[model samples]
Target chain A: MDLDFTPGEDTFRAEARAWLAAHVPATALPSLETAEGFAAHRDWERELSGARWSVVSWPEEYGGRGASILRWLVFEEEYYAANAPGRVSQNGINLLAPTLFEHGTDEQRARILPAMASGATIWAQAWSEPEAGSDLASLRSTATRADGGWLLNGQKTWSSRAAFADRAFGLFRSDPAADRPHRGLTYLMFALDAPGVTVRPIGRLDGKPAFAELFLDDVFVPDEDIIGAPGQGWRVAMSTAGNERGLTLRSPGRFLAAADRLTALWRERADPHDTALRDRVADAVIGARAYRLFTFTNASRLAEGGDIGAESSLNKVFWSELDIRLHETALDLLGSDGELADGDDGGGWAEGYVFSLAGPIYAGTNEIQRDIIAERLLGLPKGRR
Target chain B: MRFLLDAEQTAFVRTLDQLLAAADTPAVVRAWSAGDHGPGRALWERLAGTGVFALAVPEEYDGLGPLPVELAAAFVELGRHAVPGPLAETIAVCALLRGLGDRGPAKEWLPRIASGEVLVTLAPAGSYALDADAADAVFHVVADGLALATGHGPVRASLDPARRLARPTGGEPLMSGPAVRDAVREAADWASFATAAQSLGTGLALVEQTVAYVKQRTQFGTAIGGFQAVKHQLANALLGLEFARPLLYGAAVALAGGSPGAGRDIAAAKVACGEAAYAAARTALQLHGAIGYTAEYDLSLWIGKATALRTAWGTPAECRARVLAG
Candidate 1:
């Protein structure tokens, strides 16, 4: 199996690289260090969308070029290569669009797809409840049938990006009497501006309000706002989870880009005698390269229209672990300098390390992913519920 | 970018798996542990007849051109059967000889190796202490001297008794100097990749065996596999195998493609696979619950081999250091 892109693809890569070089101005988006900084980062998303370069994998109807997955991978490589600003509407573009494509009705898609594509709207996930963290099906959020729709009344804690989101998609228990807890759930969407909805920012240990606590008190959602058939929230959630594996998370090329930066950072200050630091840097590079190969293998499979099963779990685990390790190594290489915050008159290594801490916790925590691997991939006996 | 084996390779793996399964049973493993390496010799010959050993050797040396992935796949099968032989060493040595611009040694050894007539083991110094006891001739690096051993002799070792270890005395120097150093380093990288492939196979086999045993062996009125602790251990073993497999393939691909990062990647693969295989075997033994520790069972043999092989070319720490040393 060939790992190198075809000549045409390589030429395409060059063109993309040149275009990004010429058009995209280098802008450092706000580090997730402050609320105001993050809010300012939203403009970066609009700029990228205006260039038709926001999310390259979406179909042409969604403002993407309808490129193949491999090309999308190439675009990712170039995007990170240019050190482009992080997309503020990442949740909307990466998560909700894929969900809408798979489960949204035609009218629903027509309304949400363009706004999501153009960065006119931002979305947040309202999935986990106070009682349900890893055990997501145990969520206590309830939606009662109202006049023309459902009224959502519950709390969703650790709702990432909810404080500034325009809308949110949540899993609510629609039928309390259903046989299975999972069977009673329904996926519903509602505007954050709806009456009786309150979003309170939750400050993390890193002092960033990138996450929020959403309190829904009789917030009305139109019947059309329901994503799929009733009692299909679990299925809809699975599609969203699958998208997280495929497009929402850091692509393999993105890992390579991070590796290159880490390598350069290490080399600039590396002491030739410090063999241990050198070794860590080398591992970071190697890990990044292996990750790229794994991703490209997946991309090639997708290009051939092959179904990727539990193997994507393996990828998620690898990349998340690698990202954490690489950033940790970066901190170690910086020594005391690594502990300095972004504005602490030292390098950005410390801030980067702090950010890396969230890798394992986000996107269905690595522990749950391990459980998936154990049960689904290895066919091990199920754990006690 | 492709992750699948070609049809012929797939079929070949199937046949190899069957042969290994039938011939390398626990009884055979026990017998071999008593120092009989002859039981699997015929199967080795059959595999050689299929040109498994000739995969990485060039056509000019009476061998197949470089097929690192195919070679890796073959080693995986060997691991599945827990086959006891110097298959990896033979391929590694042949590749090294070919790299030295001396087709003479490779030409002399290829047909015999392919036909399983003469078994050639790798004797690179510093990586694994060469056992002069089992050597017809030893190839080694010495500071201003050459060494070789002609016959069997006494050597001290911890595991894998079927493969003895001994120190070689003086012999003729095959190649040396800066150019040979470069070639030797390149060969060592390939050797690391091959060992990693073998480790991946062994690790996978250990997981499969442990999972099967835990599912059947009852304890406390139920299968012990039903326990979360047992399940997590097996799951961790599976994780180790999954993580290492891709690194092995990536290293092989980089080496085959002559990429700039091949050396670092190979070292990483070696370190990862070494740790993975050791953990897998250790967990397998722990889960097998005393049966694995008995000399009559093959699990101990496989564990011993994994422990020995992981330390052979280089320790995981050493490989990790190499990768980090850039």
Candidate 2:
């Protein structure tokens, strides 16, 4: 397999590098937890959209360069390596946008995508509930048919970015008459500011309102907002879940950049006595590099027209675990200073370590991921209920 | 650019899988452990006929291709089947001969090796010579260069009985120039890369075997594979094995590409494969219960092999140091 980028890809990388060097904010953008920080992140997304850097992989008609997956990966490498602000529009751009492209009608795409791309309408995933987590099919959220639209009633917890998002997308039980557990589920999108909708921010371990509980009481969601046919939400949401596991949601560039930073940190504090720590540090780098190479293989396969299936579960299990280990190693390197929350004194390590904890829990817990890997990837017998 | 194997490479792997599948690898391994190298030797001849041994030899030397990536590919299958021989050492020796360019010694051994006329194994400077008694030629690896040793001292028993190691008794210095230094380094890297691939293959075998076993082996009137704990353990083992695979393949790519990070990548692959295979061995044995520990059981072969190969080329500590140095 060829590892070197082609001339076109290299040129794209050069262009991306040049643009990021000139435009990326020298200082970190404000955190997306607070109101001010959330607005600042949205503004950053707008700036990226203005420069057409927000969605390089999207089609030109959708305000992107229509770059290949390889170019998108290159863009990501440059983006993360530059330590630019995290994408505040990721829930819209990565998770929902793809579903919209695959399942939405032409009219829906024309009306929704440009706004989502421009960061005018931030999106949050309303998937998991307090009752329905790893077993998403057991969700109690319901949507009853109305005159022209549907009346939605649901409580979606752990909705990331819902605290400040403009809209929410998820599955609703649309046909109560269906006998099967997963039957009659329909994917729907609704504005968070719609009447009878409420978003209550949930404080995270880092004391940030990064996620929220979305409560919907007869929220009117138009028929046009339903992604794909009713009673087929499970199939549609599975695609979004795959995106959550694969490159779109968790790009290898993020881990690689963190690895580079970890190596740099090790170089500064290189001590021969801590052989255990050194080996662990090396392992962390190895895990990150392995992930980068693994993604390249996946991207190459996709380029060759291969479908990504349960293998995404393996990726999710690996990277989520590695992210936690990488951050934990950084904290170990910082010693007592790792607990500090101050901006200085390497407190970012503490913040990162805490955030890494959510990796396994979100996008499907590692436990659920393991089950998928076992049952689907390994072709094992179904686990007894 | 493609990072996964192309069509030809995929076909090559499939061919090797077919051959190994029909070879009764466990019986060959058992016979080799009993010092009956006949079956193992026959398998080696078949592998050579497939040009597995010649994949890394120079094209001019009657070889199909001359890339460490090919060697890595073949060795993964060899490891999967627990192919008994110094297959990795033979390929690495071929790489060393190629690295020596068109020198007289390389020309003398290159064609023979490519045609499977001679069997070569390596002893890296301070380590014992592997397959010393059976080897047609043994390369005495020094810090600076290599010497052709014709004799070997007392054979030492290996944890994995299929492999026999001994001290080199006599050495005839074959190469020692500056170019030879680079060749020696290339040889070391090949050894590490090949060994890593083997570990990956072995881990995969163990995971597959264990998954099959857990599906049938039941407890409390339910298959153990249905148990969440068993499922998670096997999944974790598979995760380790799967993740290590990219590192092994990437190491091949880096070495073939001659990237500046080749050494570090190879070392990283070595550590990752070594650890992953060892973890798989642990999981396999634990999940298999007492049956896995039995000598008569086939799982014992892979278990012993994984334990031995994990530290064969270099210990995890040494590989980590090489990685950290880069």
Candidate 2 residue spans exceeding 4 A from truth: B142-145
Give the C-alpha miss distance for residue A315 in model 2, angstroms.
Answer: 0.7
Encode model 2's per-residue lDDT on B1-326: one tens digit a residue.
Answer: 88888788889999999999999999999998887878877888888888987887878878866676777777888888888888778877877887884468777887888787788898888788788787889998765778888788888888777888888867767767888878877887888888998988888899989999999998999889988888888899989988998898898888787789988999999999989999999999999999998989999889888898999887899999888897
TM-score for chain B in model 2: 0.96
Please give, for residues A1-385, the per-residue lDDT of candidate 2 as tens digits. 7788889888989988998899898877667777888899898888888989899999988879899998998999999998888788999999999998899898988888888888898999999988999889999999999999899997999999999999999999999889987999999999999999999999999789989999999999888999999999999998988998977888888888888888888878757689988887888888888898889889988998997899999999899899999998888887777778657578367767777899999998889888989999888888754
B172, model 2: CA deviation in Å? Answer: 3.3
Candidate 1 chain A, run of 10 with poorest lDDT = A25-34
- Candidates' DockQ values? 0.46, 0.80
**Residue B53 of model 1, lDDT score:** 82
lDDT of 1: 0.74
Cα TM-score of candidate 1: 0.93
lDDT, candidate 1, A139-201, per-residue tens: 888989999899999899888888777888879999889888788899999998899899998
